[model samples]
Target chain A: MSLCEKNIFKSIFDEWNQSIQRFIQARKIAAEDAADLTQECFVRLWKNCHKVSRDGASSYLFKLAQNISIDHFRKQQVRLKYTGQMASKSEKEDGQYLMEMQEFKERLEKAIDGMSEASRVVFVMHRMENYSYKEIANQLEIGIKAVEKRMHKALKYLSEQNILKKR
Target chain B: MSESEDILLSKWLQNKLSAEEKLMLEEQYDLESLALILERQKTLEIQTVSSDQLWDQLDSKLSHETKVDKNQSGSRRKLIWVALILLIGASLAFLLLAGSEKTIQSAKGEQVRHLMADGSIILIAPGSSITFNEKDWSNKREIQLEGQAFFDVEKGGSFVVESNQGVVKVLGTEFEIWESGKQMKVQCFEGSVSVGNLTGAEKILGVNDAIDLNNQRFSDVYNHGQLEATFKSGQMKYRAINVASLATELERFYNISVRLEKIDLNKSFTGILVLNDLEKAVEYLSKTMNWEYDLNEQNLIFSSN
Candidate 1:
């Protein structure tokens, strides 16, 4: 609640507002709707101003603008779809995500399980356990290039299987 | 694109591109190809988006709408490394330590709130990590800290946080510990905690107590009430901290690479940084110091004007 913090917030808002407005405009959101989205994003930033880092603010603002704009575009259809699909279910934030991942857990395992042995082991070490390529290569007594290749292979496998989409 | 270009694109997507390498990519590749690769890479991240309908409902109900035009959202990308955490977590469940010796980490721009088996809670900042033996939770309740964290401990026998240079012990208190590079910083908001180095040096800190490598202790360092929970609101407090130190902290939480030019490294500023926008934060820093900064693609470089 310090003036310094408030000043900091004001400065950040002034600096990024125009660009975010432009981004929202580019998305074809009406000026008023764009303004509303921009305002909502900034308001959310102010409310949760303490939880985020300084250098991450602008992108955060843009992300809010982008999502809000997207939702604005999809609102009518999305509302109908949601009410039709979810009217019977009690809304649970965590449950929604958990349920989304319900089938994904086994699918994720199957994707990994189907990888070539070398690629599978490398994938497990790098992706799951969070080991570095250097460490994984050193632990397995393979070259770093080999490790990268296997990881690339594993990723390619996942992409082919549609575990990780190729876009 | 050549194999090297493919690798370069991958590194660019991962944001592992060094300044020189990034410059090379921008110079050598067409925007179209880069966008194509980037568009493809974006699909690899399977992050969850917020429920617009639910949030709209909530927004309509409790409306203390801001007068000032403002917008903010959590950063869309994880940035440094791609992590489909739920997918990885579901697969890595067996890899977790069983009895004790557990390590908890937050990836860059990721905040992890971990509840210990005991009622104590550790909220780790991004690019920060912590490790503890869960078996000792009830007995001594010790944890080893690597970067920065806010600890809210239950009234237990004793809660301890061990850093590379020092250790903090408390019965029950709210405090923050940041161990950056070689320096250890401890700030206590409420109750009292005892902190000391491994060589047996120690001090007792009470409410509003602050200490860092530069200043051993200070009575009135911050102007905020209950400084420990301020981060929950989306702000970071830096007090008389040098530019290099501040830059390092920015890289940790903001997921940005910051480097100071030769002339700007020595300047120190005391300020609160609002993390509502990244570019604006850089602008604030540059404007405050009367310097110039350039954003070349992913890197934000600040230099003397």
Candidate 2:
């Protein structure tokens, strides 16, 4: 790439590559695989930079990373099928596994919705809301022990109900 | 199904269990409960919403953002619309098949623009429908239609248009087609075009040739046969058309409203006039007929006063 194109690519990569790296880490892809995938995403973005609008570039990069992840898994599935060596689960097992996953997701949402306002707020802040426990404790004006206790109670109640497992 | 085991499983699934508690649960809980907890955790990781629900939220945000006064609003509106569209597009990608073959229809006398994949544009007229492979559009710029539209196709590989009775194919072109209720007319105003009938037989139309279809018969019309050229040629008598008929003609021409006033029933005014502006068209008609007219909000009132 020319210097200008490289600069544009570098700027875009600099802005959104962190999210891709987070996605890699969140998905628990191996460190090497994560690096490879992140690099592949940048290369793809550089290749298609002309067509992608710069305004929603973050979303575009994320979507590209997502597609690459799907492709990676699909390739892994094919390889596993040929070699008879499954990494985590067979593809059919994964399908049933996904169905179960979706059921659990629905139940989890319901459970979260049913949580008491204070407990729900505390739990969401610490978990899905991505706030530190200390931050949540400070924001809610509650003691750290109280926040942790509520989260523990919330999870225990959810698990005991087995609402997700029943699905 | 032990109560203690369920409690431990829930804690583990919630990620609220401490390191020691997690190990204890994995060791003490049955395999099934452990599997259930893993499944629950995986499910909690994804964000899924129905496309309609997501679109509703996005549309609300967009409408709210665009509702500001029209001064500093132009660029803001565009930016918000682009953001809203991109966000909706990405989220929709996550829950891919939640919306399938969904078609939204416009009310009578409405014209709307649909932004499709591949950067192509389709402007659908009132009572028209454009259907395509929602999934396939990711790979191809192809649309199947039933009714009428003006396409400003993106410049790329061949853009195919398949209708009930025929098929139209072109790389990139700006053209209008009306295909409903005993009418199928493809007017190629720019670029090259190739159209085929349902019989797998096709004909390629050049710059000015239009295909006029009557049920099974499709005939090609050259420049002289089209009404657009006559209007452009400044032939007043040749351009003269029925007033009631002119409303429908002008509707598609200017893509706006035209209200006929109290004039002679059969008044056929003949002149080469620009139909770009409805206000201007009313002015020209009023001048030619020596009638008076006023632009009242959206309505153009014409009288002999």
Candidate 3:
């Protein structure tokens, strides 16, 4: 990490490093993957600490971590494809796993794309940027109450989408 | 309509709802809402970034810009809004976040005493909160709060309370900040507190001084008397006032029935009592005022009928 990046990470470390860790874990990402994603989140925050407007901080980091998780899953798929063919369980199990991953990614993408801009920003900031209502409000120049309303709407919309429907 | 459901939803969404709101929501709403909300949040999260592409781009760009540090530093300080992000992921911080070792909790009416790894203790008041990243203790001692909390921070290094209103920065001091509703009040009990608004205006509140915030401005000023009178009393103390104001407070405190028919509505009392004692307190008023009282299970009538 560069000095700027280190400082950014350090600052984020001071602010919400815990919150991001919780978010990734809540997503059920494994321990090692969670750590990598957390580190990656800081790196992203450090690198882009200046480019995007401050309002984008929470949403940006959240989006970064989410994207990292997807990448981890995608890499896992390649590994599974090569390794599973030989030492595999039943064909049904393999098919089921692939189907689940595809469904998970698809539902997630649709939800993000479908969310209202304000709601999406709120959700992303809360989830990825690890920002609270107060921080989001400060970043966006809105009231903390407003930040809260957007978050509620975003989560409500996401939940209504049935993205986490069990198989 | 259930407060519990609202709380569960807010918790699921990671928003700040009051404890009463949380309890009401959880008690009234179905748990399915909680599960569904969590699930959707997860799904939405998984779809946001694709990964490492931005990093590769930034890597080459940063390598080329050697003198960007000074430029970025000046700009970064401008976005001090980022300081308030500390309260997120309390559960995650405990379960997965790195380098936190202390469990700090502020109860519903009890201010929690927080001893940071850096030899600092924050006395976070009731209906208020604070959490530290125990994993990162050596490098940073950060705390985030919701509602009003006080800090008697021991000296060593920088400690900050990031609230919805603004940042209360402390090198080391004692202060109480009550941030509830539209107003944010910061009172300096000892030493000095640096209060900064997001618009980048900063004010140093000295011992026994306070600043009230409205429209993002440190606009109002008060001394220790006002701060102590308001917060120290815990509840608003009304002395022999009209029934209307007392009733309003009564409604909040005890949820009792207070009906004044054929009696002086503006009649006042003399003794001072807390809202918590509305029942007995009001009864005492009735006797003093020479009024006949009818009590029927949670409902009280004060009149000559």
Candidate 4:
């Protein structure tokens, strides 16, 4: 690559690398896996640099990250199936309470999965990644009210699922 | 729950609630359930990784790959040079046999009018260009356009104007095509034309019909009563167009950079923009939009007042 192309690629990497990783991590991927996926995303981006315009770089990177994370998740599921390993359940003194908690967790996950992508992303960014609403608004390039609205909608939808009420 | 209460609960989850708001929320909702849900959500938090360290790893990997690519390309350089020279020689010979392609370009703040061999006319907008093979014009009426242009095609075989955003094909029509960035606007003033985007989606527009496309998707479809392009009459007119779109036109007309600061770009503007005078155009826009602007050599910044 020429110095100019290298500079462009470096700038794009610097601008989007952390955001892409955070985006993947927010989807419940481990930090290490998110980093690897982020690296792969950038590699694909660099390979296809000629095809992507500078103006569309952010959306392209995000779309690439989303696909990479989804593929990684699918492969993980396949590996788990082959290994016959289930997710470790939480251990508690009261077996009945533990069973109820596990069921509630599953329902919560289901509720989150059923949310609109926009609302889910906002919710996960705030809840899992601990991003402030203002920070999320800036990162997503949306108004603060939009971020709040999505948060409200997500929480409201989850509350409607009655996961906590079961307890 | 009420909208305001939901917003308050959301704020509480972020630990951004004031003492009074917390009291209000505790009194209204089940605080125990909220706390339980928040505690369980902690299990979903992914482990945090150092961004700088990851970037370091990525940088090393990229540089290593680059080195490999460079070494491979170095060995193939001589062959590529030879192939390029041969290709250039062949192309030169071919150009000598078949006449060279012709290109017409309009400079900043200028419009160029060209009459084709088949009695068709094209008015190229400022800072725009079109290229075609004059030798094959009769057989293939195709021109590659960049930026904006108004075309009046004579009734004949299919006339095609290709742009980066979309392709306009017409049998006999007068139409204006404005292509810049990812947005392409096609307005058919007479006859009919079919506009096909890079995605293969196509729209046939009759007289006075117009369509605006963004990223190969239809954004706006409308109709106008204008007989021809307004720019052809020494003025540009827009009806309820986005301020950002208008800024793009200004940038092309004046060959300047337009930057918006703290301005709502979605705000629409409807008026005539005089193409000949930059000062008058800015004055009119500022007065109508109630905006303050700063102009510093080739750059114009518009900010909300």
| Candidate 2: tens digits of C-alpha lDDT, residues B1-305 | 53344345435544577877677765744546545553434323323222344334433443443355344466887888889999999888857774456464544445556767676667766556787766667666667787667776667887888777788998446676666434466777557778877767777776656776656577756552332222222222213344554455445445555566676646554554443356676677778768787776545556664
- TM-score (chain B) for candidate 3 is 0.46
Q: For residue B34, what is the lDDT in candidate 2? A: 40
Per-residue CA lDDT of model 4 for B40-78, tens digit only, reads 766643344566787788778778777877887888978
Q: TM-scores, in order shown?
A: 0.43, 0.34, 0.32, 0.41
Tens digits of per-residue lDDT for model 3, A1-167: 23255445345455555455444543445444665677667666666666754445666676566445532331111000121222235643697766765675566656655665456556666765567778767655555655665666666666667665663
Question: In model 1, what lDDT does residue B250 have?
Answer: 73
In candidate 4, which residue ranges exceed 4 Å CA deviation?
A1-167, B1-99, B238-245, B255-272, B295-299
For model 4, the docking class works out as: incorrect
Which candidate comes out best when scored by DockQ? Answer: 4
Q: Write the per-residue lDDT of candidate 1 for residues B176-210, one digit (tens) a residue.
A: 88776556677786677888866676777777676
As for candidate 4, its clashing pairs are none
Q: iRMS of each prediction in angstroms?
A: 14.7, 18.2, 14.0, 12.5
| Chain B structural similarity (TM-score) per candidate | 0.61, 0.45, 0.46, 0.61
Residues A1-167, candidate 4: write the lDDT tens digits. 42228778888887777667768765556667888999888887776777888867777787767545542432111000011122254455568766766676667766776565557778877876577888787666556866787787687677666776554
The CAPRI quality class of candidate 1 comes to incorrect
